[model samples]
Each structure stands twice: as structure tokens, then as C-alpha cells.
Target: MHTTLLKDFSVSAAIAGFVTVLVGFTSSAVIVFQAAQAFDASPAEIGSWMGALGLGMGLTCIVLSLRYRVPVVTAWSTPGAAMLITTATGVPMEEAIGAFLISAVLITLCGFSGWFERAINRIPMSIAAGMLAGVLLRFGLDVFISMQTQFVMTFSMFCIYLIMRRFSPRYAVVTALILGILIAGSQGLLQIDTVRLQLAEPVLTTPRFSLSALIGVALPLFVVTMASQNVPGVAVIRASGYTVPISPLIGWTGATTLVLAPFGAFALNLAAITAAICMGREAHEDPARRYVAAIAAGVFYLIIGLFGGTVGSIFAAFPQELVLAIAGLALLGTIGNGLLTALIQEKEREPALITFLVTASGITLFSIGSAFWGLVAGGLAIAISQVKR
Candidate 1:
């Protein structure tokens, strides 16, 4: 498998892996920290969570991709982390861990029972694509919105991306990352001092279950992860024309999460936008060989896990504008693909558009995210249209 990855290796695939981790950690590591803080986790406990998550993601990405020979990248549930930022407060650390365990168990059951996979498969391709696009729309727009503050750096990165896209589309994101870093460095935007060299040790917290925490934290986390993260992840895989079984993957993630919950593995699931970096044509000319990109990402993830504290600092040192710019540039192709796919079926177009717009609105009601509502809205639209017909 190592030999296969080496033999099929391309610079594009390597860059894609680096870009995937860069975007993944940069965009959401802070949210994960906030989630940990909400549960009143000590510094050591919080660091442990980062380490556990990185290790889980690393192992899963490598194992799944190598075993299946597909680009089966996994990620810490970013949206789940975001949901935790708001919902975790007032929940005791022990109870939070209990909630995590419950959520993981539920996810595992859903995967093993095939209910989650079946329900996900029932979503039309247009609606799935619309949901994905809606989820990513903010990051895409942030590329431009960032220009207002860091005009020179963002503009330079954008120009470099354009130039690279024209000449070597596969490495455009790589070029943008490099240019963003260089520009940020030149402008003294990085906090190099904060990034100390160190390894992170995991701190386990005992779990204490509560019905309130189960319903408030566990159920909501489960729903947010499924609707906001896993759904888009499956959509990305299907859109990329991969035949990987979603149920087993989800089950494995849930199982992994369950084991590591005491150490802060909140949720681990398939990646959507970041996985696209590995699955894209740029990663490898032969779709079958693109698993190498995922493996590469796993390698980086392992490094991040082993040195969790340092890795967190490194990603933190990157300027917000730089991170946003690179993330947006990397996701441009994905966003375009999603929009194109969502609009392909004439009959489904309206509902899909509604889904897209609602998701893009970033609405939150009853502490549930817009992705769930968008799906509901689109499903309702489809049912109403069918009744009218």
C-alpha cells in the first residue's frame, strides 16, 4: 500500500494532503478549543482532546483509504464543535463526556442498522449538492470579504491562485498557501513566538450521564454532525464518483469516537470540503490512485496529533485572512461543482435552490443549524410540488 502510494505519487496529491490539513486545522481548531472550554476543561484536558481527535482522524483516514483504496478522508466534526460552542456551556465536564459517548453510540447504531445511510441515500442529488454548496458558501465568500482588511495579502494570494490555475490547476491551492504565508510573514502578521515546540498528553475525564445533557448535548451533537457534516461528506464522495460504503465508514468513526470520548474525541466523521481536496482530479489523474492524497493527509494528521500543542499553535499563528484566503481558494472548484450539480435536474432545481439559499443564510433556530432546516425546507418543497402535480 505504501509502495502503491509511492508509485502513484504526484506533487499535486502531496500538496492536496497538506492543503487539506492546513484548511482543516486552521478553520476550526479554535472552535474545538472553545467547545472544550465550555465544558470547563482544564488546559491539559483540552490539549488531550486535540491530540485524541487528531490521532483518531489520522488513523481513520489512513486505514479507510488504504483498506478501500479510496479517498476516504475523515475529520473532527467541525460543525459539531461549533454547535458545542453554544450548547456545551452549563454542561458539566463529566456530563459532556457522557453526552459524547451517547452521541457516539447513537451514531454507531445508525450506521450498523443502516438507517442513517438509507435516509441519506434518499436525499436527491440536487438537494445534496445544494446543501453542500450552502455549507461552503460562507468560506467562499470569506475570500473576498477578507480583502477588505488584508487587501495586499489577499489580493496577492488571489492573483497567484489565478496564475497557478491557468498553468497548473492542481497546485493552485498550494500556490495560494505559499503566497499567503509569504505575504503574511512580510507583513508581520504571524505570531511566531506563541508556537512553542512541545508534545501533548491526553487527560481522561470520567463520564456521568444526565438526561438533560443527553437530550441537550448528545442528541443535538448527533443531529448537527449528521446533518451538517456527514451528509455533505457523503455528498462529496458520491459527487466524486466513489463507491465507498458510507455505513461502515460512519460506524467506524462512531466506534472510534466512543472509545476516545474520555480524552476529548467529540466526534469523528467523513470530511466534506477537505476531502474534496484529496478526491479532486488535481490529486491524481487516475481516480483510483487518489487515495494517496488521503494517506498523505493522514501522515500529516499523525504529526499534528503527536505534537498537538505545537500543531495547534502553528495553525493558530496563521493570520485569519490568510487561512480564509487559502481555504476559499482551495474550495472554489468544489463550490462550483456543487452548484452545477444542484442545478442539473430541472424538476428538482427550485427545491435545491431553496435548500442552498436557506443553508447559506446561516440560520439557527432552537439551537439547531440551518443545514437541517434547509433539508426540511427542500423536502417540504419537493412534497408540495409533487402534490400540486
Candidate 2:
């Protein structure tokens, strides 16, 4: 893997990126769509986002891996997309676009200046592990919690997944997704009418730069996305024992986001949970070959951009429970490992567990997501415990 990327390409590497693409796009594409809805994005605007994000992620990953000679991957800003649901609302789309650009600039600054790396150095390994666990735990719980209302639909899918995992673990997630769709359609749990088959045409919105949008949406978003998401995202790569260039990777993602902001690309950041899966041994035994997986992901993302509405509709077709169950199963290993890592140390264990539990509890305070507060509370716990000593 370290020697050179092209040198590592194998038949196995070729499919790694494709598998990554399906996992990423299928897993949380709907949530991203819902987030766009909160910002009052039209279908075209949403598709543009999907398109630009695909283009940015694809171009960057493909370029950087070949250029840098590493299995480097760039992901659309998942946390930033997550933020739009609650924070990007009421702001004009143009201002949000401006925010996207501004945030990209900041991200670039972080990379060029090496400030992010410097700051990351200060974080205790245990705390970083805890935060990673905490962040992923939210999605982990969402997987099952979603089933509370849709049990029959979810349970059947779970059973199919179990059977597949026993027989063919490699295709378990994909098979489960397929079975979920079939069962959902049969049960009448799938909703197909809302799907618009038209190709997504990019609507150019003249960006309206506002200090207010920068102050409200852009700054906090850049902070949370970088600190909460990218920080852990990078950690996942390092933790998985991959040593790639951090600064260049950040710069590439930031630059890509800057280019696509005109088309409503909100944020582009490294993926933590999902990227780890692709980078880890599970994706391929040979580390040198994982770039192929990222390439596959890029190709799939391009396809998503081409048929944004149709692809979006297909994901929406399955009963919601099926998606939830699949996500839970796919992420279960990462979640459990993260929690175990977070609590392994004696001093940090309690605080880390508090972080995980509070984050998992889904208690939102003062309009802020629990992901942030979990960090705050855990940090406070660590601080106070330190002071007592």
C-alpha cells in the first residue's frame, strides 16, 4: 500500500471501491436528502448537491490516490450534510452556498497552516477514541430505534441478513438490502409514487455572501464538521493502521468543495465510520489494494449524480426499517470496537462511557446535537476528575 497505488491494483482492489460506494451511498443517502429538505432545497438543488458532491469526491479521490500513491479516499461532508437538517434552515440557499465556499477556505487554511494537525496532537488517544465511538453510536442506535415503529418490516430483513452472514458474509449487506426491498414491496411497505424519474438538472443559484450566514451556519458548521467529524474520520484511518498524508487529503477535499460550492456542494470532509470499513482489513487483506475500493466508490457516486432523482427514489422505495436494520448490522463491528477502545483505560473509561451513553441517549439540548454535547460533557468529566487528583 505504501509503495505505490497503481502498483497495488488487483482484481480484488477493483471491486473494493464499488463495494465502498454502495455502502456509503445506500447507507445514509436518504438522511442527506432529508437534511436538504430542511434547507428548503428544490429537487434540482438537491440533485445538484448530489451531483457536485459526487464530482468533487470522485475527482479528488481518483486524482489524489494516483498522484500521492496511496489508497486515499475523499467523502462528501457527511457531518456537514447532517448539520444542514437543523442549522442550514431559514438561510437563503445562496448564502448557504457562500457558507460552503467560506467553510472550504477555512478547511484549506487548516490544511496549509497545519493547525488541524497541531490541535489533533493535543487530544488524548483515549478521548479521540471515545469521541469516535460516541459519534458512531448515534447512527448505531438509529439503526434499531427506527425499527420501533416498523418491526415487521425490519425484523424480516434482520433475519435475512443473519442467514446471509452465515452463508456468505461478504455479500450480507448487499443481500439484506435487496431482500428488504423485495419484502418491503411485497408487504406494501415500500412507497414508490414520490419518486421523480427526471434527471437532475443543476440550477445555478448566484451565491449571496453574508457575514450572518458565515457567522451562524458556516463557522459552527466548519468547526463541528472538522472537529467532530473529520478529526475522528482521520483517526479512523490512522487507527486502522493506514498512514496517509493528512494535510494534502484535507486540502484536496476542501479544494473540491470550493469548486462545487456554486452548485450547492455544502461541505466535503473525510468519512470516519464508513471510510474505516473500506480502509480496514475487512475490505481487503492486502492494504495496497484498497484504492480500487475507493475508485469503485467514486464510480458509483458518479452514477448517483447522473440519476440523482431515480437513485434517490430507489433508496426511498424500501420500507424505512430495512435501511435502518442494514445500517445497524453493517456498523455494529465499528461501534462495538469503538466503545471497547473508548473505555479500555482506567481514568478515561468513566468519562468516555458518559460520552457514549449521552450521545447514544439522543438528548438534544439548546438546539445543539448531542454529538457536540457529548464531547463537552466528557471533556468536563475528564477535567473535573483531573482537578480532584
Candidate 3:
């Protein structure tokens, strides 16, 4: 592993890691903040939550990636946080913390029992690919949508991407990142004042368990994180053709969450969208070397954790168009590859297409996102087709 990192440390991989963190933080950090507020957490507690989550994610990513020698990226439960935003309101902060602990325990059990791993392993690769493609389809489209706001910046990045792709394939993303920053700065879109660097202090809260909190918040969070985040996360690994053990990965997340829940680590699970960024060929042409990107991401996440107080401002300082453009450009190849894989099998083509379309629709049913729904639709399609035969 040491040898691999020393020889395969590419600028593209590092940039990929940076881009993944930027997109993850800018896109969903607000939801996290809102969730914290719903629990009536003080500002200090919120900062602690950020620190705990950041440390959990960072440490997990580094340990798991190094252990497996695969890019086993872990993330805080984005969808789970969204769930809490609605369900956690009116609940006491103590109960909410209790709910978090309960959810963590449940997640850990799922991992230790190996039930979740078995279920994920059974998913058809075509459907898995379609689900991943569906999840990422929006980001891919955002690349072009960014043009309406930052035409010069978007077009310039796109052109540089094209030029670099033809000339220096490995550094295409790195070059685009540089060009995007330069263009954003030139246009005065960058806000320097919003960014204030400081250290974050963790605040611990004691959890008081309740049946109502368990049923209302804990169960829902656990279900959403598992169904929405971890499921697609497993698909990303398989879609990328890496065979890391899913059970232990899920188990470790649960364990980390259990230990850190007092500090606001609500739920930790395998990553879906952001993990794809690290797992893709753009991160490293040689799959074996891609773990470095995940490690790099872990380091950046640690920085975010230490400076949790400024995370919101720092990410906010970057123009929305830049974030959208960079994330879209970064995942372009992964989206295309997923779609192609989903559609390649003749018999599975229709089901895969249905999965992709449903997922891309962005519809929400029962507070669950379209990715899980897409899989359900694809499964029904396959089942009906098989029944006809």
C-alpha cells in the first residue's frame, strides 16, 4: 500500500478527492444544519456534531481503505439527516440523541449479522449500475445547466476538459478545477470574507432513550440510511469492479456511529454518490491506486472537522455554479459508464432503462429517494418479464 501510494500519487486523484468533498459539503451541509436545529441543538452542539461526523467519516475512510486496499469511502447519512429534519422536530434533544444511538446499533447489527451484505450482493449488476446512473444523472445534467448562470466559467471548464482529455487524459479534471477557480475569481464570484478559519470544539450530550423516539426517529433514520445510502454505495463498489467485504464495512460504520453519537454523529454508512467520485477511473487509471484519493478525501474531511465552525462559510464562499459545474464534470465519466453497463445486457435492457428513468425522475415516495424506488421498479419489471416466460 505504501509502495502504491508513493508511485501512483497523481494530481488527478487528489483533485478528485477535493472535488468530492466540495460537492458533498456544499450540496448537503445545510440539510445537516437544519437537522441539528430541529433537535434544538445549541450552536456549540451543532459544531460538535460536525466535528464528530467529520472525524467518523475521515477515520473510517482511512482505516477501511487501507485495510481493504480498496476505495472504501464512508459518509454521514445525508438522507438520514433529511429524515430527521422532518421527524425530529418536537422531539427533545436527549431523545433525539437516543434515537441516533438506536439507529447506530441497528446499523451495526445489520452489518454484524451479514444480512445487509447478503441482500446487497444479490442485486443484479445491471440494476445496480442503473441505480447508480440514475443517482448521478442530475449531477451530469447540472454541468450544462450551470451554463445559464456562469456561461463563461462553465464553457471554459468544458473546453479545457475537452482539450485536456485529448492531450493529457489523466490531468483533465485537475486542469478543469484550476480553470474553474481562475474564471470564478476573475468574474468576482468568489467571496473571500465568508471564509474564516478556526478550530471546532466538540460538545457532548447524554442520550435519553424512549420508545417514541426509537419508533419515530431511530427506525426511520436507520431504514433510510440503509435503503438509500448504503445500498447504492455497495452498487458503486461492484459497479467499479472492486470486491471489498460489504459486511465489515457496514459494521464499522455502525460501530463508529455508536461511539461518536454523543458528539452528534447521527449515522455513518457507506457512501453512494461521493464514493463513486473516488472509485472512478478519473481518480486513478490504475484501480489499485485509487485508495489514495479516498485517503486524501479523509484528510480533507479531517480539516473540515477541525474547522467545523467555518465549514458552512467556506463552502458557501464558492459560487454555486462552480460547485455544480465541477461536480458535474467530475462525475461525467462515471455516469456514462453506469448507463452503458446498465443497458448492455439484451434481456436486462428494459428493466435497466426503467430503473434509470425512475431514478432520474427524482420522485420521493414515503420519504425515500428515487434511487431505492428505481430498484423496486426495475425488480418488478424483471419479475413480470420472468413470469411471462
lDDT tens per residue, model 2, 20-107: 5655777667767886777788877888878777777777767776665456666766656777777776788888888888999999
Error of 1 at 145 (Å): 1.8
Per-residue lDDT of 150 in model 1: 99
Clashing pairs in 2: 16-293, 17-293, 17-294, 17-296, 17-297, 18-296
- TM-score of model 2 vs. true structure: 0.79
lDDT of 1 by residue, 161-191 (tens): 8998898887777778888888899889999
Q: Give each model's whole-structure lDDT.
A: 0.87, 0.70, 0.89
**The best candidate in terms of lDDT:** 3
Q: Against the true structure, what is each candidate's TM-score?
A: 0.93, 0.79, 0.98
Q: Between candidates 1 and 2, name the one with more favorable lDDT.
A: 1
lDDT of 3 by residue, 1-389 (tens): 68866787788888888888888888888989999999888988999989998999899988998899898888888889999998986799889989999999999999989999988776899999999999999998998999998899999999999898888877888888889889889889889877888778988888999999999999999999998898888988998888988899999999999999989999999988999999887798888989888988888888888989697798898899889988888888899899999999999999999999999999988888898999999999988988854
Measured over all alpha carbons after superposition, the RMSD of each candidate to the real structure, in angstroms, is 2.0, 4.1, 1.0
Off by over 4 Å in 3: none
Pick the winner on TM-score between candidates 2 and 3: 3
